[model samples]
Target: MNTDYTAQEIQDLVSEVLETADENGVLPIVQLGHPVLRQRATAYNGQLPTQMLEELLEAMRQTMYDAPGVGLAAPQVGIPLQIAVLEDLYPIPESSALEREREPLEYFEIFNPSFVATSDRQAEFFEGCLSFDGFQGVVTRPADITASFEDREGKEQSRSFSGWQARIVQHETDHLFGTVYVDKVETRSLINESELWHHDDLDVATARRVLNF
Candidate 1:
């Protein structure tokens, strides 16, 4: 990637962001604290070509994979758009032998998604974010949510999400509005922003070289 920026780059970035947001399934997300994150952009055109949609989906999938996270927001990488990419985690049978017992960590690559309606039920989860860096928080959300999303081409699709899956969608969506998980933290006990990132947290570094390498 070319990291260089020109005075005219803003227009290009914005143009690329919109075009990429339309073509790349999960184009790179801007990190938190980016100024444009808080502003809501226009919704999708709803009638883009299908081939363009597929490329967008593939780009999104690659974005999530490269970021090394279960989900990503359009704004998190630098683009200010109404989109995100995530892998679904809820429907998996917990009893499956391959299932990992821990936090909800399914993968997703969603675009222009909406929480159609949320269930009355709600729960709190210890959540983390790529943008916030090291802070974790307790965010309360519906136990289940029926969400609708468009495919890469802007076609309409929907799904019922509950448990961990519902929580993930709710969390990433907040990113579109410039909100971080830290904003939803209910109790100070569940979070430690000051200690979010520390060398001691890395097992390999601590055991191998205490010299702060």
Candidate 2:
């Protein structure tokens, strides 16, 4: 298989993949080895070819919900464009008290999103990705962040996010830059999601060793 893919080629291939998905009903997610996932996504210019961009965004939203993931990036679906969808509005069981503080976010669509840290506070958590299914890794990210981007309607939007929402935005935004959360994780910190446990009371140091890796 050809591993070398130019940026344009990646985008074109994504379009093809999406076209094929129309018959299958869901966008086929590109996996870890795809060259498209490694290339920096192109900025979305103000152009919507036959409402294709809108349809793509909606499809991405559906794909995200189907994957049961909080966020999805264009690159994950093979479209190397600056687009992503995320929402954390699902009900959390009271037993998962650690996530109680994470504010529920309505579905958000960001195009050409850019992230900035708003505070010095930092937090680390075990995060999973749709691209790297079934695995989780510890990633330290800013606890508070503000991201600026254009909404689906092309209006500029900027919002601050903290807790899990901040991590979601940071993770998705990093995908646009061709970076994955695993890139920031210690090799020893990687674990299968099934083997992970809640470590709300444990310190970060202890949490790393708590997992039966």
Candidate 3:
């Protein structure tokens, strides 16, 4: 978040960063240091009317698209709601290798997902969280998980995830509980936001210029 350049230049640069990221990959959002990261988000109190839920979902979608990250949590953006958004990052086999280069990002808002089961198989996945700001770490996690939660409207739902998707769901669910990715990692060997590279480029959008959305 530090830059010595002009405020006007920084503002213009922020615009480009948002634009570049949304079209290439989901933006990695502002993480834990911003105060919202530490607060345990409140679960939906059955207060949101149907329209409100829809509006909330739309805003989350746009925010996710803007931050250009594959996923985002409600608390990260200052919302205390227990809601969380996740877009699947798995690529389809039919997609070209180039297309597959960026992980598939699909949206899901799990109202209050609880882990039903965790696989015994352990695997290490390098993970990044919007709440963690600029840090990345290698974390060992269960390879599969079955979880249940409510959707945006509080309807009951359940799903099982394997591999990377399972990891993402677990990571985001942790955010709702006010947990950062660093908590899961064995070591705090930090990878600051500036140090991250998406698709081999530190500036994810600049490296992935051709992605239309």
Which candidate tops lDDT? 2
The positional error of residue 108 in candidate 2, measured at the CA in angstroms, is 1.1
Please give the CA lDDT of all the candidate structures.
Answer: 0.59, 0.79, 0.62
* Cα lDDT tens digits for candidate 2, 71-184: 999989877778899998788765443642477789988999998999999887678899988887778899999999998777899999988889999999999988988899
Tens-digit lDDT track of model 1 for 98-151: 322224555555666778446577665557777766556556677778887776
- Tell me the TM-score of each prediction against the true structure: 0.64, 0.85, 0.68
Where is model 2 more than 4 Å wrong at Cα? 1-15, 22-24, 95-100, 197-206
Ranking by lDDT: 2, 3, 1
Clashes of 3: 11
Model 3: residues with Cα > 4 Å off, grouped in runs: 1-30, 89-105, 193-213
TM-score-better candidate, 1 vs 2: 2
Q: Write the per-residue lDDT of candidate 3 for residues 1-213, one digit (tens) a residue.
A: 231244344334334434433444444455557665766666665645565456556666677766556677766665555678888644445433232233454677888777754668765645776566566666767777897899865689988877667777788788887788887774644456465544353222332333321
Residue ranges of candidate 1 with Cα displaced over 4 Å = 1-11, 14-29, 46-59, 88-108, 190-213
